[model samples]
Target: MVDLFGHAGPAQVLERAARSGRLPHAWMLAGPPGIGKATLGYRFGRWLLAGGAEGGLPAGSAPLHLDPGHPTFRRILAGAHADLRALRPNTGEGGVKRVIRVEDSRDAIRFLAMTPAEGGWRFVLVDGAELMRPEAANALLKTLEEPPPRAVLVLTTAAPDRLLPTIRSRVRRLDLAPLAPADLDPLLMRLLPSLSTTERATLGRIAEGSAGQAVALAEGEGLAMQALVDQVLADLAGRRHWHPVAEAVAAKRDGSGFATFMALLRGALSAAVRQAARGQGAAPWLEGRALAEWSTLWDRLGQLAAETDVLSLDRKQAVLTALLWLTPPRR
Candidate 1:
């Protein structure tokens, strides 16, 4: 019901597994962020609660399409469903916690032990399951090892590799690929009607197939940061002053703006390297550079960015240093 796009194959696989009546007690919906892993998990859970058999519907109805007006859908949306439990990381005094705590993980196990109030099936959806702490992962793994009857647990994660190997082995894994740029157009057009066609296309390129990220970028300073990256690249070979741009980027105290700028910077470098490799005309800044030099700069900047985050380095200084590296050596 969340306007899912793509992944029909995965949906059908779920339906087949359900119809076979040997549905796994736990399912891992793995994919990049914002591509609807959580959405699909919820939909499948809703379908199962609504008597999963496709036989009751008219011809060719999607197995997972529950009517929005239905009580099950309404309850899940309102978080009042008696037979369903959904978990995400909790916020603390500092901010949102990076990991799901062990207490919440144990609570989910308790929720599974109870008989379904609906007298049918109970479901637990763990969004961002990879964020579970080590103890939390171990606690959940116990339930996965010996799941309760008529219960299902769905775990959605961007990085499936981070899950404990024992936990990963217990769940049926479904990996969702990112949507194509063209597929993102409808979402961008609908969510960001004021943006021009060209702007949308650029977002499609920079968003890298995550519609959620595309919308978030449009809502934030992403476009402006991308423009700054373009400006820096266009003037990299010249004597133009760049301190103003670095200062402006550093002044973005929210951190997301600076992060977006760095990401766009890396993307630009990647584009230039790809163009050079393909024997196409590279970006203007790459005019006189060796492919290896450009590649090395890209790798170096990437490491610097990671270190800046880890070590809390001065962002302004980092930007200045990156710009200096972008400059070609004077012959």
Candidate 2:
């Protein structure tokens, strides 16, 4: 299981259901990206597979705690478990696919239908459930309506609203809130011990309570991307040249760096918009701009990112278009 931190309330809720012998057959774990919804799902699976009996922690152990050395934990981690199955977007030659196909969802449903190999429980975890294609979601919805006995299906998603309404209606939804900075601190320390204090602090602020994102930012071009965003915002304020920033983002062949750039850009714009709306903390560039201008730019950036992914549009052009939003014609 992923190294889980915080989310004690959700953990206890799962434990209580197991203890009461009323554990729901279908569960929806909803939260923002990288906030440990999937981690909690995996931990719950580990608890079921390891504890064998539910309801109470052993003696003084924490809620939903299981020994890492336990055979079940090892099996699940190694993908050697017979009764445990998971579905996520499959990777293709280009990269991770954008959506989970219908066939994959069918396979998970079939796995759940089978009798537990260990004569205990069968588990299916659909990580990023919102990525399921329409056909895939419909197939899952059918099974959710009449889930198999002694089988548990867990769906974790950052965007629950993207899921089919029928599918959402069938499962017990549990929303996980973003972790606090305090909660994220220890996680960062453990996962990124090599990071300097300043680097970790920057990640914590930009990550917005996502431990996974913080770790990713620490390991990848996140800091550089962040610096670029800051430079772009400052340049916008001064009406200075932004071609260098756009060119830098466009130079990355794999598009990962560009994606990071967009995420940081969106985050920064979102903060600025909120501040502008509240009539406080508005950045100098935002002082004279109408709120709609900032909000529209933010929305346009998101649309460009999505269009680039689905339509395979030119990323360089996308970056140029986004920068043009801030470089309106001088009166």
Off by over 4 Å in 1: 59-63, 92-96, 271-292, 306-314
lDDT of 1 by residue, 185-280 (tens): 887888889999999988878877877888888988888899898888878865466888888788877567668888889988888789778988
lDDT of 1 at 179: 76
Candidate 2, 1-331: lDDT as tens digits: 2667889899888888877888899999999898898889888888887654453246326667777787888889898999889888876437856788899999999999999998888989999999998899999887888888989999999999999999999999999998898888888888889888888888988999998899888777898889988887777744355667777886778888889999999999898888778877788767556778888888888999989978888887887778777664465
> Whole-model lDDT for model 1 versus the true structure?
0.84
Task: Pick out the ten consecutive residues of candidate 1 with the lowest summed lDDT.
Answer: 53-62
Candidate 2: list runs displaced more than 4 Å: 52-61, 92-96, 239-247, 253-259, 276-280, 301-331
